[model samples]
Target: MIIAKIALELTDLLVCAGVFLVGSVISFFLFHVALRRKREKLISEAEAEAEVLRKEKILQAKEKFFQLKAEHEKYIGEKNNKITQSENR
Candidate 1:
């Protein structure tokens, strides 16, 4: 009768251990899923910021190009006026 009691106790212990292991696996799986979602959100935000910066850089370059073009045209017009005055004199 003592041996039967011991055997029942052992069975209960095994069942408890199995339940604990399954719970641990489920907890780990949920934690990993939450972590992956957070990581993806951060990556998406970074990509959006990078796209805005790229657009800003392109706009700045275009403005600089227009300024330089205007200066070059003004310089050419001044040179032409000087040449015409010299020819008249």
Candidate 2:
């Protein structure tokens, strides 16, 4: 009877250990999947933000170019007027 009890207890302990191992493996896989999803989300968000900043920089550069072009045209016009006046005199 004592030997039977010992065998039963060993079987129960082995079943419990198997269940624990399986549970741990499942939980680890789930955690890894969750972390991967989070990393992908963060990367996507960062790319989107970078795109927005690139567009903004392009727009600002275009505005500055136009402003510089207008100023250069005005300067040329003034120089031409001065030359014409000097020639007339």
Candidate 3:
């Protein structure tokens, strides 16, 4: 009778331990998935912001190039006018 009682207690202990182990594994798996998704979202947002900044820089560069081109053309026109007046005189 004592041996039977000991066996029942051991069986109960094994069952409880099994349940606890399964619960821990499931919780860890879910936590890992949640963290990975959060990381991906933050990376996507950062990449989008970087792309927008790059486009803005490109636009500013194009504007500066056009402004410089205009200024250079105006200077050449003034120089040609002066040369023509001197030749005429």
Query: How do these models rank on TM-score, best leading?
Result: 2, 1, 3
lDDT of 1 by residue, 1-89 (tens): 99999999999999999999999999999999999999999999999999999999999999999999999999999999999999999
Clashing pairs in 3: none
Which residue pairs of candidate 2 clash?
none
TM-score: model 2 vs. ground truth: 0.94
Q: Which ten residues in a row have the lowest lDDT in candidate 3?
A: 1-10
TM-score of 1: 0.86
Top candidate on TM-score is 2
Better of 1 and 3 by TM-score: 1
lDDT of 3 by residue, 1-89 (tens): 99999999999999999999999999999999999999999999999999999999999999999999999999999999999999999
- For each candidate, what is the lDDT? 1.00, 1.00, 0.99
Per-residue CA lDDT of candidate 2, range 1-89, in tens? 99999999999999999999999999999999999999999999999999999999999999999999999999999999999999999
